[model samples]
Target: MKRDMRKTEREISKEEAKDILLKGEYGVLATISDEGYPYALPLSYVFADDIIYIHGAKEGHKLDNINFSSKVSFCVVGDTKVLSEKFSTNYESAIVFGKAMIIEGEEKTHALKHLIEKYSPDFMVSGLKYIENDQHRTTAFKIEIEKISGKARR
Candidate 1:
């Protein structure tokens, strides 16, 4: 299969791409509904074991879209700064193509814990209690990455 096509010269290595994903605070997840409409939502996520984990309400448009179609795209932009004098911006970004599905049991709990670590490291005790209390109130999903590419303008 062919590799990334856009800005091939500026494409970064897999390691760089993964690094960006790990450090990114949020990402945009794109999905296609059953009616053929596309939807994109910005969400907080955790990158682990080469998979992307996201949590949300047990039911919603995102879940509906995922149920209708497994294919999805997620994008994360990092370290962006506008350079007015140069009329351009310096940035790093990564786009991931993958299949997503709701996870349950141990895997779901593990992903949730990872999220706590990433987002609330200082409140681990409270976070654990919160997870225990709300575990049934939320749903955790994992995206098994198929293809990912990173680019930079620095």
Candidate 2:
């Protein structure tokens, strides 16, 4: 479903949106709990091959939510600042709606390694060691983005 942006000037191009997602430091993964409650958490992630990958413990609230429902949404804010004089904030952000699923084996390992490379590229030697030690205890999931939109106020 597509919604018209009230502020046409603020709508960002798809390429721009993809760039933001690729370079973003982190994003919030929103999920629905088994109890039908909304749960959102900030997470470190890596965007690769048109997929968003995140790593976490083998089990937790987020995992539980993903198990209960594959539908999820992710949001990343690029930059923001409060414009006190105008009483409006200037910001750029992207939101993605997608299906989330737990992945294992090589896919999981690749995602974990991608994250290590993104966040700890300077320490890859130890990063690989860390991944080797914690791989089994970690759960990696991928979000296949179905719809995405971006907006910005310059």
Candidate 3:
């Protein structure tokens, strides 16, 4: 599959791919709606134990799309710099293909904790409290990654 890339020289190892994923601040999640329309949205996420966790309002287009089909694609672009003189950009990115499912109870909490750790480490106490107060109003999903491909131009 690596040979399929337009520029195989930019293809990166799994470890390098995962590193870019971990450092990415936001990812674009792509899903197919019931009518076969494709929807893509940028969202905050947490990567833990090979699964990507995302949370949002319990009712929405994204959730509807997930219900229609579990298969989804998530893309994360880490760092980029435009090298005008070189007429190219240096960047690191990763794409993930996966199946997403709603997570509940302990699993949901676990995912939330990981998110807090990544985004609000300094406010752990308040984060925990906020989770308890807000968890019920939110919905969490875990994406079980089926295939991951990463590339970098450095």
State candidate 1's TM-score. Answer: 0.96
Model 2: ten consecutive residues of lowest lDDT: 1-10
Tally clashes: model 3. Answer: 0
Model 1 misplacement above 4 A: 1-3
lDDT of 1 by residue, 1-154 (tens): 1364667888998899999999999999999999999999999999999999999998999999999999999999999999999999999999999999999999998999999999999999999899888899998999999999899988
Candidate 2 per-residue lDDT, tens place, 1-154, comes to 3677788899999778888899999999999998999999999999998899998888889999999999999999998999999999999998889999999998988998899899999999998898788789888999999998899998
Taking every candidate in turn, the Cα RMSD to the unseen true structure, in Å, is 1.3, 1.3, 1.5
Against the true structure, whose lDDT is highest? 1
Q: What TM-score quantifies how close candidate 2 is to the native fold? A: 0.94
All candidates: TM-score: 0.96, 0.94, 0.96
lDDT of each: 0.94, 0.92, 0.93
